[model samples]
Target: MAFIFESDLKAFLFCLLQFVIAIVVSYSFSNYTNPEQRKLEKVAMLELKVEQTEKDIEQLRDLTRSLEGKYQNIESVHVPLVAFHVYNPLHTNLEVGQVIVYQTVPLNEGNGYDRKTGIFTTPVTGLYQFSAHICNQDNAMFVYAIVLEGETIALSTQRDMPSSCNTVNALTVASAGQQVSVQGVHMSKSYQVIENPHRKNSFNGVLLHRT
Candidate 1:
């Protein structure tokens, strides 16, 4: 009976060893069959990302070129101002007291659009104020505005503002080396004196200081 019990215990031990060995072999085989598959997937994903980045870079380059072209066009641009035949005596469009018709510099001496003459060429670059004023003997003078480019009316305004004995209207023009003119039938009187020609409205409208 003792021999039989020893034999049974040895068989059981042997069976347990076989089971563990089988499990280990199965696990190792599974890993070895597809060892490099995960690495290959990672490589493919990296390649896709790199391709997308290249496309993005190409698109950005195109956009940059387009913007550069537009900037070049803007740099070459020149804003044209309207001109009239001041020498023509038959020009009925000339109004009384219009400075463009007579004044050397048609720009207002007050830094305002008070002086509406022909186009005044810009001497320097920056912000410029334009203003106009009108007074009627009947106390019902209406003020109008038309901004022109050469012969084209870029803007016009019929908005009548209240006026004193000498009504005034004004606007600002940006940049330099452009032309400006009055676009109405009525005329305006210029200021008597200018203080600082360099500074806007420093004395009035005269650009006296060297830019």
Candidate 2:
């Protein structure tokens, strides 16, 4: 009876040792695998954040390029221009309603004024200021008109005198291709005269504002 009890105690201890070994191995494996799984999850989240940041940076670059292109286009199209000044020192004869053509050009920026035809053509739509100085050396009367598109807008008249000077100026809006000129009106004498270089009979036009 004593021998049987001793053997049963030995067998019980052996089974208890096996159960403790299984519990220790299970706890060690759980501890090691849990940390590795958490690390993998964190790595995945960081990679996703990095991808989102890259996409945001690309979008910003595209917007900047678009704005730069628009600025370049604006710079190419919007340019300011148009100015001219002409003079005539030689003597000229004109009949009724004849244009007083200038033969000398001091400054013609946009080439809007024609010396031979005595006319100015606008290059752009804008407000323009025009002026004319008429000098008569002869004793006869001299009269001139500033004409825009064949209509007299301003007039300058000088009576019979040894030396006479008359000036006329006008401010008006003009479109592209519109014509402006100075015309002579018939007085008691048939000739309209321009004196020497000192008299400086001149005509000038300038652009004030662009529409």
- What TM-score goes with each of the models? 0.30, 0.68
Tell me the lDDT of model 2 at 178: 96
> For residues 171-206, could you state the per-residue lDDT of candidate 1 as single tens digits?
454445665554444423222212122212111132
Q: Which candidate number has the best TM-score? A: 2
Model 2 per-residue lDDT tens digits across residues 1-211: 9999999999999999999999999999999999999999999999999999999999999999999999988865564778999887334677778887888898998899988788999988889999999887578777888889988888977875677778899999899899998888756565667567577788899998777
Clashes of each: 19, 0
- Tell me model 2's lDDT, rounded to 2 decimals: 0.84
Q: Candidate 1: where is the Cα deviation over 4 Å?
A: 1-7, 30-34, 78-211
